[model samples]
Target chain A: MTSGTTISGRPGISAEEFGYLAGGPGRAAEVAVVRLLEGGLLRISREGVVSAVASGAAGAGTPLEAYALGAARTGRMLGDLVKSTATSEAASALRQHLVDRGLVVSDARRKTWSTVRVLCFVAFFAAIALTIVFRVHFGVAIGVAVVALLLRWFAGRMRRPVRRAGRREVGRVKVAAGDRVGMVAQMGLLGRVGQFPRMYYVWEMLGIVPSAGATLRRRKPVRNSGDTGTMYGSSCNSCSSCSSGCGADNSGCGSGSSCGSSGDSGSSCSSGSSCGSSCGGGGGD
Target chain B: MGVLDKLGVGIGWRPEIDLTVERLPGVDFVEVVAENLHVEHLPESILLLRERGVPVLPHAVSLSLGSADPVEPDRVEHLGAVAEALGAPLVSDHVCFVRAGGLDSGHLMPVPRTRDALDVLVANVKTAQANLPVPLALENIAALLEWPDGELTEGQFLAELVERTDCHLLIDVANLHANALNLGTDPNRFLDEIPLERLAYVHVAGGVEHNGVYHDTHAHAVRPEVLELLGELRSRVDPPGVLLERDDNYPSDTELAGELAAIRGVLARHA
Candidate 1:
């Protein structure tokens, strides 16, 4: 679902390009990893370890994919995989390409903008000091301070790595990405860790916390026997109590017996009960 | 058996795999958990499926149809509203109680197979059916333990319920597999005794064996035995629809497709 041109007739951005524009090299690397995982070229374990099952496959078309495949050959943890891939020569080249297309600010330009903003802050304080010491008109000093503050704000905006065009391009990419792989790429470009419900485990494996105050709420992972966390207002201790074999001794009730209890007490078990698995012994609706 | 329109093959739709469900090839229908959706604001993914003419069935979990208490009107209302919103042909819930004595169990507890328990369940089902806009189908759940003083088997209990309430049945073979392994319930006997003509659909899911017990986890891959059970059911009747459910620990799309393919393969072989 890649598009070559935006609606405005400008060159559109690829998912990786959008990732770089939105969050930089690391984000682009994450998109590549997701692509490989979706393509079945790589495998991620429940523990978040990534291994390349077919590293020599012809699907490693992009440079980042090639780098990610190489990194996963030895079964690397997801966090380390992203880091190693992000710092690789391929990532550096991707950053350079985005800069060349004017979608992102150059490193030198961003550094200069940051320095100018600091100088503006210094000028603001200096003007206020001079006004108080030399008994100059308060209006003149206030004007100087206001101008310095405005300049500092402008410099801060200039220092942002992603330019206006780049943001627009990323937005376009998001609209065009309608399928599963594209949606995963959109999550990467938007810095939405754990936003993609199916891929949250991947982010958790990457050891990246969902960004603070993310718009989309982070959903609790699905409860399984493997997850001992609390769910549905109940805490599970172990898989033993939740198993179907918990009450094997009490299978049948006599016809005239008083065992016709309205509620099945064995259905839901507490943390202390022998059937303490809060997930209900793995039998879910 | 021809009462239900042919739904072919489908999968359970979850918020986690919205896009995957939307793009999965040959998806004839999808079942959404009724308790998880809001009628006023359905998910875009669901709306898209509806626009594409996919049958979106609402499967409720908290209905507590087998509870000793009367069926809750609010829960029934919500299920009805979801069905109406999705234009669903029918809706389904479990023949088990999730809450009783004002305490929520959070799991589908099997109803005791006693005449007294059956009387209460019949009354609740009729109440739910009267309030529901569309037809309601009840599914059999896998139980870790059965209540004592049982006067009937699982099949006889369901057959009487259908006779009393005229509700449909959603047979889950995986749950049958779990029961066959854990509680020694005879799947063949259940199939033989139940009224197959009243079956609206079939449910197939995956599970794992742990400590000599087969757990109906729905997180793992579908075992060979569960598929064999599906084959057995297919041998008895051509089910209107067979849906594959994967609730947690979702596999890759390729793996999920393969599972669906395996289910279709079993049906095809039996056919």
Candidate 2:
């Protein structure tokens, strides 16, 4: 998912250098380049400007070549201009390949880790309870609590970085071409601001996407999805915004509907409703 | 009256409407999803509420106290940790089972009203209470369907459970309305049957009617009938506080304020 030149099989200038011609990493721009390379449909000049090969597979005047040539001329990286944007597909493909070759661990390991973590917690608490029952002394209780807390804290610290590393395996490059160019250009103008753009993905994961007020507004579509009547999508999204409302990233969605169904409080106790411990913030009605 | 008596109108501190909630002109306290909050990294909004001295109740949804299986000690420990971290005086969860036989229903499924279910719920509640750092109040859930083997009325079941466990009640008037509307039961009769003194706080929420069945979805606006039910409950027993719960389709700040105002108005008239 890096915006760099890691298209392992491709020859000639790396994707980053080709991106330099269009200004930066993008979906449509990457698709055009890959198509050109695959079908030998375009000739990339020594100067990095891309031009249609007269006997190209897509021919000179075709929409694909025209778009590629246009991107080359204007230094624009088209991302998501057409339905065939390959960024997501490429990321998934690469991820699967890595998993297949054992370069990356399979998702089943993550599940095992999670289950083990929960069991660790259960064992830790059970020990604490046993200590309290057996010792029945204030000093013993304090010592046990302090030691347990420290152990839990250390365990959490150790797990977080590794979990984050595992997560990066699936983190796709979602940056658009224009934004990428703007990011590069603005890096100098905004000293530490350069680090800020890279943090966008992380911040978005945290649901605190800075300057995404409009993006939040566009999320109205979520409210209208099939789960709208049940308030599943919006509630879960809101719950996730509540600092990882449920346990896993998407677990909130499943429990969001569950929280609202006849079983829990149906809607009230689900992520946002104030029904129970997982009540998103709203009282369970 | 308990410490909750001094507290007044408040709303659930939903992250989606955190800004709207934070800006409320007057609020006694706010409740947060216990599972959503991490003890070490609490939401900034929740921290601000604590800084402002607004009580934050950690409401849990997955405890599944009535499940046949023993409650997870880890889950109870997590709840205890959250309560301690937030300095909450009390915490709350539902009286229904969320998972059974190792399969999570993903919803609060109803426990049978039989004596066997009652014994299981009482034992689970006692275990949860022992693990919790503060008092645990359990709320009754709104069920779309009832178990066939029910041997007691909902009120009688709650009354007996509370009597046995010495637990408090987080009564949801909206749930009462839903049950009354869908189950053909009298909400007033329900109010009369429950122990009024056990009321910790009252919960009011909104739901929709679909195909003649009232669904307590908490996604829609709080219907007037729910407010009326709250009024009726207040008349019978002035609960320590009333919290307005709005889960989704969150309206503008003005509308939320209006809902809070309406709740306050109801409390005022009853008072």
Candidate 3:
């Protein structure tokens, strides 16, 4: 709870805590599901329907995991599973604990701060309007507005749930997690899908198609904070258009080494070429 | 000592099954497609493998050494950067062309097996080798058609290329099987001619036959004939490394592990 408090003496932070610190309740739920899947307690079909493979909460390592496993019994979709789990009693309890530790802002406190901040803005604007209508001395209006502005700033600061200590904890956990799948799980769909593209079934089940163009445009070189090496740049301008031509610059030809061709060994055999037979029609060796 | 270091059985490191690759036991090394990766922003799984002291080889698909055009400098630089980043002992690409005359074929296309093509390939290989921080290993590809007027056999061409460039070889037995089935290129002839001492590793993958054409679809299970061919190669030389390539339609981790085990089995029996 405190800045100096240690979650454990172990190297990496727990996936649940890391998820909550990094992304909140929904992410924590997702991490739990990932854990269940990794532990072989749950199964997700290619269509994205998640089902509990194990009966009861026998193999679950945490309360959240047990809750997730129980919720998955009826075979909910991935999105639904995360949504329901986030609102579950277990997730609520976890959130309350974090709030008590001052790592997160309670919903009630956040709402109160938001209302006060809005009132401050309204009061400040009203004071200026009154001054303009009465043609009174502007100094009084300016002073009133300044006080309102100060109050608004304080409320805004209070509205943010994650405290400084929480941020520090998140960073520590991330560094310790390193390149492990635990880190990937903490990142939710983006990290899981990006690192494991073969899991496209997750997207298919979610009833959403990821835009290739958007994905390519948003892609930036991932650099660790400690890394000081130069990051290489990609010339792929458009994901859709570049498939056939982007990397095909004079720098090198973009051949499909996996595309079923004998060209890699200095032999002539192209499934895409005009010749369809075993030996291309041209000349004999 | 072997021509290359002892690299136990391995599998292709793909984005889809990254975690599976990490958990799968007995994986001595993993090969990554160079073009699919950005040297600056590598996937964490690859970095993890490197951190674990696992050999990560960058296999490029776009070097197009067999093309009539000059080797791409940017591509070579990228491959070199990847090798340096992973601290790999060597890297690999195919012996085919992907583009010609400013047009991209998008698939690996065979090069003419004449002296002229070999000269061009050798020059490109040397250029790539000079730029790369590690030794260059070239893999033979699976093809459906053979170009006319070829002057050399596949093994002779690869042997001459290695002799001239002092490069290494990544012989793909699955490709040899595909060629044998479709193009009538003898796998034994290929194994007999190439300098096995220069072999850095071997690639094994599964494929299917449709209408009598054996497609080197890395998606399928490794065919028995391919494993037999691997055994035949094992009979000739002790390859330092052997990797299973599964690019698409990935099976369960159990199936992949079984394939790797099958590869190990062949190596053990032949040994």
Most lDDT-accurate candidate: 1
Cα error, residue B72 of model 2, in Å, equals 0.5
- Give the Cα RMSD of candidate 3: 20.8
TM of chain B, each: 0.99, 0.98, 0.98
Span of 10 residues, lowest total lDDT, candidate 2 chain A: A213-222
Candidate DockQ scores, in order: 0.02, 0.01, 0.02
Candidate 1 local lDDT, B1-271, one digit each (tens) = 3326688899999765665677778898999999999998898789889999999999999999889999999999999999999998899999999999999998899999999999999999999999998999999999999999999999999999999999999999999999999899999999999999888999999999999998999988999999999999999999999999988666667788888899899999999
Distance from true location, Cα of B212 in model 3, Å: 1.0
Please write out the lDDT profile of model 2 over residues B228-250, one tens digit for every residue.
98889877877887898977555
Judging by TM-score, tell me the better candidate of 1 and 3: 1
State the lDDT of candidate 3 residue by residue for A74-167, as single tens digits.
Answer: 6666667765776677876776677677776666775687688779989899889989898767998898899998898677555544555655
CA displacement after TM-score superposition, residue B254 of candidate 3 (Å): 1.5
lDDT of 3 by residue, B1-271 (tens): 3325798789999765676688889999999998888878887778878899898988999999999999999999999998888888888999999999999999999989999999999989988888988889998999888999999999999999989999999999999999999999989989889999899999999999999999998977889999999999998988899999997666666777899999999999999
Q: Give the least accurate 10-residue stretch of model 1 chain A, judged by summed lDDT.
A: A248-257
Q: In candidate 2, how many Å is residue A78 off?
A: 22
What's the lDDT for residue A75 in model 3? 69
**Could you estimate the TM-score for every candidate?**
0.59, 0.52, 0.54
